[model samples]
Target: MDDLALSVRTARPEDAADLARIYIESWQDTYAGVISHTLLGAMSPRTHTTRWQATIRTMEKHSGTVLVAEDARFGAVGLCSLGKARDGGCGYDGEVYTLYVDPAFLGRGAGRALLTGAFEAFKDRKLRSCLIWAHAQNNACFFYEAMGGRRVATRTTRLLGELTPEIGFGWKRLAARKPARPMQSRSDQS
Candidate 1:
């Protein structure tokens, strides 16, 4: 599958529905035990679609961006959002607001490719650093760590009658550095 073709591009308004589907699927699968069942159950496909459409519209209105990863077979398999960090009170210089890969594509390199694309976008904007947040129970924390992110802070809150803790990871020069070695490559995976 080394020759399997895939592309990464800036998300378009037309891609919102597909992006949302992947987002919801990934979230439900990855966050099932970590988030409240009530919250999870409440997030229907319509909710994700509406939210993604609105976000895409707003990003188009402004200068922010969303990105999508597409494979020849799976169409859009991953998505991510990037914008100025100040939009939220989290206070990072820049933020990766969303990053989700289809559950089927999880072990592949689609997530890394999507993130590398985001880093290029941030670099083009001259941003110096960026932040990503993941729930403590999500295994993505380790992936971020492997990608050179440093744990900067931890946040705790109650969701769905349970205590959920989130960890924040920061990449000081998300756009400027190169990986020391090539990440593993997979063909036709995403």
Candidate 2:
């Protein structure tokens, strides 16, 4: 964290609105030119708030997790949602469905903290390997690459009637990390 004083914690239901706002904001900042302007224009915090509320509750039943990264100076700067891998072909045990740092907090180590938190969440579920998908044209790929991710696969996903190219980054073996909360063992959680 390098003096960032960032902390990661499981998200609560009340956080949906804020998470939604950040999600939309981050998307607007990162995907403006990458995705269709019409699609982005249609995104609203109201719909996402409901979506995030359901996601937070549904993940509990599915062994998935939503973690928020908070800095001492800024409340909730970033978040990550991850769980068991969805595609069997990927051969990864865990996958990150969302990982974004608010644009205002982009360069201050929030993204790195979020990735580290994702690994920790995966460890909690006994997952040893992980993968994350990013838009092929998105600049976050370099951040993932710098964080030790390898470009292993590519695919196109249909989003808002457009075929959007994406790249999948993977980690075959994740190094162990210090527990987010010291009171208990992560292995005990699974």
**What tens digits encode model 1's per-residue C-alpha lDDT throughout 96-131?**
888999997776677777778888887777676888
Residue runs of model 1 more than 4 Å from their true location after superposition: 1-4, 87-91, 157-163, 176-190
Q: How well is each residue in 1-190 modelled by candidate 2, as lDDT tens digits?
A: 3344577789999989889989999988987877788889889889999999999999967778898888666678888899888978389999999998888877766677778888887888899999999889889999889788999999999755778999999999987545333322333345
Q: What TM-score does each of the candidates earn? A: 0.83, 0.88
Q: Which segments of candidate 2 are over 4 A away from where they belong?
A: 1-4, 176-190
Model 1 — TM-score against the truth? 0.83
Worst 10 residues of 1 by lDDT: 179-188
**lDDT agreement of model 2 with the native:** 0.83
